[model samples]
Target: MLSRVANNLIWMNRYMERGYSVLNLLKVNYSAHQDSPDLFPWTPIINNYCGSDSGFSSENSIECINHMIFNLDNQNSIINLVTRSRENARSVQEHIPRELWLGINSYYLYLTKPELPNKLYQEDPVVFLDRLLNHQLLYYGKIDITQERGSAYYFMDIGKFLERVIQISDLASMKLKEIAKTSDALERSFLWKNFLLSIGAYQLYLKKYKSTFQEDFIIKLIFQEQLFPKSLYYCVNKLSRHINQLIQTNELVNNDLEFLLGKLQSTIQYTTIESINEQGLTNFIASIKNDITNISLSINNVYFSNQS
Candidate 1:
């Protein structure tokens, strides 16, 4: 594969994954703020996940939300992600099919228009989010149906799967900490539901467990479920499969990347929630984050960097 094509494929996946991440964060924060009257807390979420929240420096809920959601200065915002994705698509327009590029371009242009953000937030936030999600789905579907199943496809899969693994781990860590600290069962239950909804896993959870919300079961389902797409284990497993396939066909292998992924996957596969909680959830999550960071660097070395 050409270096330029590989770069485009990687970036295309990254941008879409970022847009989805921002959308999920916005939805979760919005629901939490709306449901809990006293808990008008929003800044912590922005600060933790998005570095741009620091610019606002205000504890006010509405102000922080507006700044995070609408301010173009926040490069990680939904609009900004969409814009960047379009720019990435533009850069590789010659490599991608014209129709596919046009679809992404049109979507971002619509999102970047001056009036869309205000109208979206004012007219109906949920509906606006739904529309954005639908567009994301459309782009993903287009890639699946239109793109060839080759090195480029594998790179795209790597980007999407890795992003999902990191996002789910972060969400689980954040929400589990909240649950552990909270004394009120009702609040815990609400937070757990919100976490599931943020990952688009609520309905799936209900279908799989057929039981009321409980912390242990929720943790198991989110972290360990092999069949669930958003689960960290599932994402890592899928990533490994793709990487192995790439190695086999291209005769290109990176031992460091494989070792990191294998170790992370094994840890998740064998460990129990009891051990995780007893040992300290924060430490376990931090370890996983380190592993992921290493795996990403290895991936760049093997497939993305010019030196590779």
Candidate 2:
């Protein structure tokens, strides 16, 4: 596969994953706000998703929803995510299945409807977000059914798990920040529940833990649990497997890339939740973020580099 095509595929799926994640975050936060307007604030979300550098801040839930969902000027908005993902798909139409292209194109069209903003504003916001989130799920289903197991598919998975790691880390960071602001157990519980709900892990959490939410157990669940699809360990482990497949097929061969991934996987896989707490959650998350950023840079230089 051409490096350009591989790059496009990686970014295409990254955008898709990011858009899906943002929708869930918006839905969860919106519902949380309804439950306790005083406890849930949009500032952290705005700063996290809107890009702190964008200088966009809104306390009003409705206005934030408008900016996040519809404002094209906000580069991270759902509209832009769909637009960019579709554009990427359009560029690599021959490299992807027709159904996959249609799924993304349909997603773009849905977001383009001028009434979407109104639907969120006037109608139930959760329903509005769910419609879009379900579209994302359908999009993933199409990929699984249509895309063959090859370099193209591997690259898409790489993009997806990479984006998932970043999103989960960011969510953890935001929730931990909020938890730090208050010592009240009720507020802490709400923050943890909000975090899990935002990531679609609440049900699994309840089933697995089947008990009260403790900080250690919640941390273990999100960061280390192997069965949980969204856990950092699972995502990182999947990412390693996909990248290894690419390397085994000789589609990608970079010692630095392999070494970085190995180090990252071991860093997560070998550490205990007890050690993580001792090291401090903020610092641990920061290290993971830094490692992911480096690994991404390495992947770009190794496989997607113009020189390659």
Best by TM-score: 2
Q: TM-scores for all candidates?
A: 0.89, 0.96
Steric clashes per prediction:
0, 0
Please give the lDDT score for candidate 1: 0.74
lDDT of 2: 0.87
Quote the lDDT for 210 in model 2: 92
RMSD to truth, every model? 2.8, 2.0
Give the alpha carbon lDDT tens digit for every residue of 1-308 in model 1. 66566666666777788678767777666767876845436655676656643566765545555565567877667667677678767877766667778889878877767887676547556666667778888888788789777776787788788777777777777776677777887787787888898898899999988988887787788778989988888989988988888878763466676788889999888889888878887788788888987887776765565211
Candidate 2 per-residue lDDT, tens place, 1-308, comes to 78888888988999889988998998889888988877899888888876778777777888888899888888889898888888889999998999999989888888898777777778877788889999999999999999998889999999899899999999899999999999999898999999999998999999988987798888888888998989989998888899888888888776587788888888888888878989999999999999998888888876675210
Candidate 2 segments whose C-alpha is farther than 4 A from its true place: 53-55, 305-308
Candidate 1: list runs displaced more than 4 Å: 57-65, 302-308
